[model samples]
Target: MTEKKNAAAIRGPSDHTIRDQIVAAAMEYFSHYGFEKTTVSDLARSIGFSKAYIYKFFGSKQEIGEVICASCLADITERLNAALEKSPSATEKIRQLFQTLAVAGCELFFRERRLYDIAAASSREHWPAAVQYEAALRERVLAILLEGRTAGEFERKTPLDETAMAVYLVLRPLADPLQLQISLDTAGEDANQLAALVLRSLTP
Candidate 1:
């Protein structure tokens, strides 16, 4: 028992490495068991370290959930940016953005139901990281709209910023996890049709 406890107490080579491991392990547990079910001691045991070690990196389990939520959104944003880079037209880019977000949101949020719980908790906790990610999302949508206007792919009857905001709001449901799930479950609306409708609304 003494040897076992000592073995669990061993730290990783460095703080960064240890922190990454903790986050990675937490992600697995959170995905499989859920944020509410996973505990600090559980995480520590999984990483072969003490709860104190996890504390050295994260203040609490909620912090780990926040990081996971933020990381998931960051990944989605990267995919959206990549879609923009590869597509030929602003219209195509807009379509790609919706498709990308729809798939990514479903995979990330729906793949693990617990992630949705974490997201909800983060919202209630007022985690600024999630809020910042959403703000960045709005900005990216605005950028895509401005690009479309410049290329004459889309018309802007409203002010540029207003139009962008409106577009974001209108299309947001398709990307929202709960809304996306509901739409898929009840309406059987795939991402392709959804993307097309959004693109059609902006057609010149």
Candidate 2:
């Protein structure tokens, strides 16, 4: 984690690295100050670059903000996928998902609260990526839930899509206007509560 943090908070990028350090500095600043309040000059100065350099990389503050959100979400989806894969049971899988979200919040918020805030505010702009990520996550969850149902681990009459949507609804606030950042412990419990509620509704 320390290495990853160091990698992100750095001077410049390697020829092979996909990320740009100038953008990293800008994102860090924006996360702290917010998109509306942050300026190109501030981001440029922070990274020791001219404002022209910043504009060369990102046309506007909004573009920089959106790109940062995309980068964060891409990283987050990887963590979420790992969490779902490692859990021992469907109930635990749900817990893992929330815990992953909490960890993501820490990484994003500790690094840049404003990035998460800005992303939350302009979700529609990134809706296509968001939808793709959600579909992939939901499919994994649905498969596990179906297995649990078959094993009598969970009870449910709700369609898989509906159940998955319910789970998304519970956690969606983590990303948006509600912008609720939670501890890992709280996120885990919230996941458990949501899973339990869904299961109880399905109980015969």
Candidate 3:
């Protein structure tokens, strides 16, 4: 086994902590320099560690990006879960979700846009973390849909999973920087119109 892996095996508690340090450093580099331009060497130098040492925890730059993006996804999931506890109608919850994404998501993913490239790259690479993140997103949507269906707020004719996936896809572009940039002025109107359409479709 690799020395770093061997060391991690010996110190189980510290293993994940040390890896988090590397991920934190990589996020800084990725923020300053787009993911395509940030090299493993840059990340190593930033943390005062050898490139080989960084590899002990992360196999590649893509893995670092994947992990970081996954964390972001997880954070989003937590917020959504917290909102779910308020027991809002599923339609209202979904409407609030789209509004939040249209505004906050655009601001973070487009206006700030530092880590946007990493997310896009992760999607392109088809990394497992990227896939997991998407599944998590779909799951969130699914939860909302199932809740609405159970409450009789939504059409029973539609399949829950497929409807959830459709909702995710429909709202995805509003959060996409490229799409937002192309038609910035109309994004708000577009988001509202789309949300209305989706919510209308959900009503029985």
Q: Per-residue error at 204 for model 1, in Å?
A: 4.1
lDDT of 3 by residue, 6-77 (tens): 222332234877888887777787788888998899889989999988777766777677667666555555
- lDDT (tens digit, per residue) of candidate 1 on 1-204: 011111123334456667668878888887778888888999899879899867766777877776677766667778888888999988888778777877777776557778877765665565765566656668878888889888888887868788778777766766555466566553224656756776787777
* Regions of candidate 3 where Cα sits further than 4 Å from its true position: 1-14, 110-112, 175-188
- The superposed Cα distance between candidate 1 and the true structure at residue 22, in angstroms, equals 1.4
The TM-score values for the models, in the order shown, are: 0.78, 0.67, 0.79
Best candidate, lDDT = 1
How do all the candidates rank in terms of lDDT, highest first?
A: 1, 3, 2
Query: Where does candidate 2 stray beyond 4 Å?
Result: 1-19, 48-53, 122-131, 150-152, 174-188
What TM-score does prediction 2 earn? Answer: 0.67
Worst 10 residues of 1 by lDDT: 1-10
lDDT by residue (11-51, candidate 2, tens digit) is 23343233366666766787668877778888777778788
Over all chains combined, what TM-score does candidate 3 have?
A: 0.79
lDDT of 3: 0.70
Better by TM-score, candidate 2 or 1: 1
